[model samples]
Target: MRFATYEHRDQHHVAVVDEDGTLRPLSGVHSLTGLLTEAGSVPELLDAATRMLDAQPGPHVSEVRLLPPLQPPTVRDFVTFEEHVEGVRRSVDGAAGVPERWYAAPTFYFTNPYAMHGPHDDIPMPPGSSVLDFELEVAAVVGRAGRDLTPRQARDHIVGYTVFNDWTARDLQSAEMRVGLGPCKGKDTATTLGPYLVTADELEKYRDKDGFLRLGLTASVNGEVVGEDLLSNMSWTFEEMVAYASRGTVVRPGDVLGSGTCGNGGCLAELWGVRGRQDPAPLKPGDTVTLSVEGIGSVSNTVVPGADPVPVPIARRRTRERP
Candidate 1:
């Protein structure tokens, strides 16, 4: 079943997309806040929520604002795509030596929840970011909380999946990460999520016989395809990521774990290499980027140039000491 949060007639409400493409509101079915109140215990809330949709049905597909499916207690994103890593490595000078361990273990970062935006939302370009880019990823929503869970156990903790666009400012990232501050200013700008949340059951069929998710992912700018790939290309699995994240820490339900950019699947650097050094195409103002993951949904966002002034380096005057 497809679930979404939208605003109709001045009030924001949760609704289920019906078979006929209409938005059927789920009244008294609990707001996003109330739904998240019971995260992590593997509560019957999602089942109950799905039943509510069955009760009041609407169209199959209609125009509506798709908000982030859940209010995550925490949001963490992982870098599990070797192609993206290699592409980034090739971009930077003397960074070609990627540790072999990076290919084995799932690495992740906690992102700011405040930066999340809904589908069809406008992503404001950061100031001085002439090189804005988009990343296509599949984010898993945690359904149960536990510590030190094994990889097998981690699979049971997932409730659903959604398409995620990790918007980026390449120039800012390059400068900030040099200080080893963990992608502060470069990554804190905005992240696009949703269109709809597809339950784990719905996605089960998409999993291949090899036990890997086989969702097709694609990203386009202004209707022109920029990046395309499959979820199966990921070097690390979501279960591994969850198990790693849950190590010695409680991973509550609704917590979002992003599967970083797909292999050659998103971003110009991965698709066409980096600027100047490689003649890659970077995003500019007035470009619309859309990230679509099959079986989940698609999120479309427009990018505009930052209107703020660029920071200027201060010139220091040397004072002569009296002899």
Candidate 2:
């Protein structure tokens, strides 16, 4: 079953998305995270959502404001695509190939969960940034808590999938990473999730023999297709990424695991790597970016001008005496 969180008549609701794209509100449920935690399991949640759908559909998808499916407790983005790594290395790192350590295991980085945006929300240009960009990927929402889980065990913990756009500030990211500390301010601006959350069972038909989901992923900027790739191209599957994430830590319900950027042209930074810096220009105010995942859904966000940067003092070095 598909589920959505939307706003109508100034009220927020958690609803079951019907086959025709109409919404059927889950009685008394206003938060997707609350519902997920309350149900404790996907089967139970599905049962409850189904029971609530017996009522008349409330509104058509076009009539309401779509929201980020859930407010995740934590967000971990994994770089699972070898091609994306290869391209970025050549472009940003000025290297020819991927590092061997990348093949050792799935790797990820945490981003600001508080900065999430909904499917159709307006994303402002982050302060002091001129190179605004978008990343096309999918994300898995944890339904049950688990720790030290293996790949197989992790599979059952994921309840649903949603389209994720990991917005970036290219110049800021490049500068900060040179100091070996960040992608911090660069990525803290916005992370888009939604349109709708498709249940794991709903995507079963797309699974390949190797257990990878062979779903087509695409990204467009102002209606022009900028990047396209198959989700199956990732070197490591979501299960592996999730398993690696839980190695020594707990992954709780409502936590989100992003599939990072896809290959080919999953993000503008990757495009800059393949083409030149100015080929496909960085996003500016009034640009609309739409990212779509085959089985899940599409999230389209409009870029808007942000407030002027508030200046801060530059770091000053201090002299130290030998102890």
Candidate 3:
């Protein structure tokens, strides 16, 4: 079953997607976080949703505006695609290859959950940034709480999947990383999620013997396809990323784990790596970016100009004398 949150009569409503693609309103439920976290488990939530479906019909998905399925408690994005890492290093930083430590384990960074946008929402260009870009990836929504979980255990905690767009400011990211710290200001702008949260069982048919999801992922800019790849190409599985996330910490329901960017031109930075320059150019006002994942659906956002940055006073070096 696919789940979604939509605005109806100015109030948020949670709905389940029917086979025909219509939404079945789970009356009284306002958000996916409440529904997902309140339930004892995924099976119990499904049972409740099934009962709701038996009650009455709801609105068609096309009619109601969709929002981010849930307001995640935490959003951790991992760099699990080797090809993406390689391309980014070569193009953005003019480096040759992936870092040796990158192969040791999956690494992730936390982004602002408050900054999330829904599918079809307009994305504002981050302040003081000119090189806006989009990343095509998948995200898993944790349905159960757990601590110190193993990879196998992590699988059961994931209730569903969704498409995630990690919006980025290339120039700002470059400058920040130079200080050896963050992608903070560069990435905290906007992260798009939605269309639907597809239940894990719905994707079993697409899973391969190797445990990889063989779904297709694509990103298009202003109606032209810019990037494409298979979800199966990921170096680290979602289970692995989740397991790593739960190490010595707790992962709660509604927490999101992103699969990072896919390979083969997943983002504009990768295209610049192959072309030696920004061939397609950076995203500007009026451009739209659409990222789609097979079985999960798509999330699209249009670029809009943002306010100019408010200048900050520069710090000055001081010399100590006869202290």
* Model 3 misplaced regions, further than 4 Å: 319-323
Pairs of residues clashing in candidate 3 = none
Compared with the true structure, the alpha-carbon lDDT of candidate 1 equals: 0.76
Q: Could you report the Cα RMSD, in angstroms, for every candidate shown?
A: 4.0, 1.4, 1.6
Cα deviation at 270, candidate 2, in Å, is 1.0
Better of 1 and 3 by TM-score: 3
Decoy 1 TM-score against native: 0.88
TM-score for each predicted model, relative to the true structure: 0.88, 0.97, 0.96
Worst lDDT run of 10 residues, candidate 3, spans: 50-59
Cα lDDT tens digits, model 1, 162-250, are: 88888887888888778775777667778887987677888888887666799999888889886789999887778888999999888
Quote the positional error of residue 283 for candidate 1 in Å.
1.4
Q: Largest lDDT belongs to which candidate?
A: 3
- The digit string of per-residue lDDT tens for model 3 on 83-196 reads 999988887789988999999999999999999899988999999999998999999999999999999998899899999999999999988898888687999889999988
lDDT of 2 by residue, 161-184 (tens): 999999998888888899987588
Worst 10 residues of 2 by lDDT: 48-57
